[model samples]
Target: MKVTVFYSSDATKSAAFDVQPSDTVKSVKQKVIALHSPPDWANTALLAEKDSTEYFDNRKRLAQCGVVDGAVLKFTYARNLTLMEKVELNVQGTDTGNFQLPPMSISTLPPKVAAY
Candidate 1:
């Protein structure tokens, strides 16, 4: 079974992996981390269905979690800031006790405009 995984911090960033029904959520997360190579600070990754409140347990198998082939799973990295967020923080000099901005969705972006 093949599943598409998207990073919650950046929906535009996603990866596809060929997984087995018997594969555990932890195994799937390993594959995604290997492929995407997200920041080292990323401690935990949670796999959830898009627009769904339920999340798969790392100890449970894909089949047990009701995951099927061609399913879209959103990967959320909890307890750490994303690479882009880190860069922004550095640029803003947050370490210097300067202004701090609230955490927001990195996936949201303004619509593109075409140039003549």
Candidate 2:
């Protein structure tokens, strides 16, 4: 089956790949980086447009994540900056940091956090 990964920022830019349903999301991302890496490719992630319910674990299979053949996955990266990041960028002579947070949403506390 063939899958195309498109840049979340620009749909016009995308890359297609021939992969099996069992292929891991990590492999797809690696393929993009290896064959046609987008800008700032390091530490990038592949997000499923159809299912953004939970975090896409690196080991998760494309089929498990609802990424079927012909499905277009969003090639996304962290966009917003944290408070410290904003400050660092504004402060003169400060070197830019390379840290990038993953996309997240407010949800019920985890078992550990809820217990606490």
Candidate 3:
């Protein structure tokens, strides 16, 4: 069985892995971490689908989590700060601040605005 994993930070980046129903989520997460090399503070979670918010438990097998062959799982991370966010903070010339901005999707921003 093959499973497609999509990175939450960058949907354009995805990887397909050959897996078995018996494979545990933790094992899959290890594979993904090896391939993507996410930040040290980042923790990976597997979402069953693109629109699904529910995540699978690391202790559960793929079969037990309702994952089937050819399923598309979204690989997401919980971290301190993303690279982009860090850059933005640095550009502001401050290590600590009380500014809060709404999350912006690259697709929604104008090409020129999104370019930076």
**lDDT for model 3, on a 0 to 1 scale?**
0.78
- Compared with the true structure, the alpha-carbon lDDT of candidate 1 equals 0.80
The true-versus-predicted C-alpha distance at residue 86 of model 1, in Å, is: 21
Query: How well is each residue in 60-88 modelled by candidate 1, as lDDT tens digits?
Result: 99999989999999887665565566667
Question: Which window of 10 residues has the lowest lDDT sum in candidate 2?
Answer: 46-55
Using all chains and alpha carbons, the TM-scores for the candidates as numbered come to 0.61, 0.56, 0.62
C-alpha positional error of residue 58 in candidate 3 after TM-score superposition, expressed in Å: 0.3
Q: Give per-residue CA lDDT, model 3, range 1-116, as digits (tens).
A: 99999875766888999999999998998888788776677654455566698878889999998888899888877755656686687689867445565565656555664545
Where does model 2 exceed 4 Å of error? Answer: 36-42, 50-55, 79-116
lDDT of 2 at 95: 55
**lDDT of each residue in 13-92, candidate 2, tens digit only:** 88889999899988877877675545663445546663353547789898888777798776666545565665567566
What ranges in model 3 sit over 4 Å off? 43-47, 80-116
Sorted by TM-score (best first), the order is 3, 1, 2
**lDDT of every model, 2 decimals:** 0.80, 0.69, 0.78
TM-score of 3: 0.62
Worst 10-residue lDDT window for candidate 3 reads: 96-105
Which model is ahead, 2 or 3, in terms of TM-score?
3
